[model samples]
Target: MGNKEQTFQKIIEIAYVMFAENGFEKTSLAMIATEVGISKPAIYYYFQSKDQLIAYIFDELYKEIQQDIAVDYKELTSANFKEKLLELGYKSIEAQGKDPYFNKIFNQYVLLAARDESYKSQLVELETSFLTSFVEVLQWGVRLGVLDDTPHIEAKAQMLALVYDNIGNFMLTGNQLNYRAIWKEAVHSVIQGGKDDK
Candidate 1:
């Protein structure tokens, strides 16, 4: 990579660690520069502002997840519908758990967006892309008859959003509930009367 590319990547690496550890608000460019063994001005050469850095991280995370799902989609042709659905559930959990610090950054992002209309719109777009993948999986399940057809795919999307909210809550509160068991019960509740009895 060129020096510019290398420096840009280094900045992202430093920002990821700091944002993960200190969160977006608590993290500062000076701290990231200190960690990167570079001056603050050097950091500026790569990113104009901390918000940009945070946005970059969001983009990176989204791209990585979409790539992962694309790979999984290609391999699911032979898998049974139940197996694919379970795989998707597991993948969703794993995606949230990607970076140990991702949860903190994610929650902070949500809070920031809530207070700022512009940030809220950008955040909605980012989150929509992330959630859309799971929505697609759920739609696929319905198509395969593992999950019953809802009139619209969006109801399932809303259900998955609740699931995502649960993950964010687990990250924020460190609540000790048995999430696995809770999820199983919740999923059953959502689909109980809807499944085709064969």
Candidate 2:
């Protein structure tokens, strides 16, 4: 990367840590600049304000997490849909566990979204994208004649996404629950459309 791109990326990395450690309110541009060995104005050259920098951080983090857990949609089939979904769930948990600041940063963003429209909009878009992945997978299964095309696909996808989020939250908070089992059960239920075999 060029010097300017390197400096911009450095600023983002430093700012992310500071926000995760000190929070959005506590971390200032000056502090980030100091950590990055650049002038506060240098930060402005890349980001108009701390909020903008944080929004960028949120976008980048989301992309990284998505890439880490992404499944090959092109290769998806009915026989492997459940397995792929389980892998997605497990990989999501693994990715979150790999990043010590992920939960903290996510919580910070949640708090920011509570009062900031821009943050709220970005979060809504991110969540919509996540949900769309599940919906697309379900639709793909239906098209392949391997899974039922239930009318409640969207609702089911939403519930699955919620389960993943809660599982990550519980694990991060040291709740010590059987997350793998919980995740497997959740995936099974979604796949079965909440039916009871017995």
Candidate 3:
């Protein structure tokens, strides 16, 4: 990468660490600049404000997650649909676990969203995209005859998303529950529409 691109990425990486460690309110542009060994004005050259930098951070993080758990719906077969979904759930959990600060940073952003309209809008857009992807997966299942064509598909996807969100919340709170087991149960429940007797 060019020097400019490298410097830009360095600023972002430093800001991410500072935000995760010191929090959004506590971490300032000067601090990030100091950590990046750049002038404070240099940060402004890339990001108009700390809010813009954080929003960029969140946008990049979401894109990384989407790429990590992406499923090729067209490649799925009825026989492998459940397995693929289970793998997706596993990957989501694994990704969160891979970054010890991710859940903390995510929760911080959620709190930031409550007081900032721009953050709230960005979060809403990210969540909507996530839910839309889940719905698309469910639609693919229906098309493949793996899932029943039901009117509540969107609601079911929301429930599954909630499960994943709660799992992150639980982990962030130092909960010792078996998250994988919970995830498996949630996946099966959503797949069966809560009618799974097995």
Candidate 4:
């Protein structure tokens, strides 16, 4: 890479660590510039403002996560529905284990979204986009009659998302909380009451 490109990437890396550690409200562009060994104007030459930089970093991370999940879709097996889903969940959590900063950054953005309309909109869009894949998989499971549809497919997908997020949290922090087992039982006990009526 050229010197400019290298510097730009280094700035981003430093800013990512700062943002992840200090969060959106606490991190400052001056701190990032100082950490990157550049003037504040130099940072502005690359990004218009702190918000823009934060958004760029968030967008990149979000895209990377979506791509990671999409690629994992190919690894899913023909096992029983719940087992396959649990496998996917396990895989998803395992991926997070490889990158501790990602979920921290992601969670930071989510909390930032509460006070920033632009961030809120982007976060909503990101969630919807990611959920589409999960919804499709759940719909397929329902059609095959291998999964329950009691609370409905969409709700099931959302619950699965929550379970995965919690499991990821547990894995990242090494928390003693046992959310995984509870969520697994919840999925297994969806009651099979929709189209299958079991």
**Ranked candidates, highest lDDT first:** 3, 2, 4, 1
lDDT of 3 at 156: 87
lDDT of 3 by residue, 1-198 (tens): 998999998998888878988899999999999999989988899999998898899889878867865678777997778777878777777777777788888888889889989889988988887878788888888898877888988888888878877888877777788888888897897677433322
- lDDT of each prediction vs. the true structure? 0.68, 0.80, 0.83, 0.73
Per-residue lDDT tens digits of candidate 1, residues 112-169?
7888897799767766766776677666666656566778666766676577557656
Better of 1 and 2 by TM-score: 2
In model 3, which range of ten residues has the least summed lDDT? 189-198
lDDT of model 4 at residue 73?
41
Model 2: residue 101 alpha-carbon error in angstroms: 1.3
Q: Tell me the lDDT of model 1 at 62.
A: 60
Cα RMSD for predicted model 3: 3.4
- Model number with the top TM-score: 3
Ranking by TM-score: 3, 2, 4, 1
Which ten residues in a row are the worst by lDDT in model 4? 189-198
The Cα RMSD of model 4 versus the native structure comes to 4.9
Best by lDDT: 3
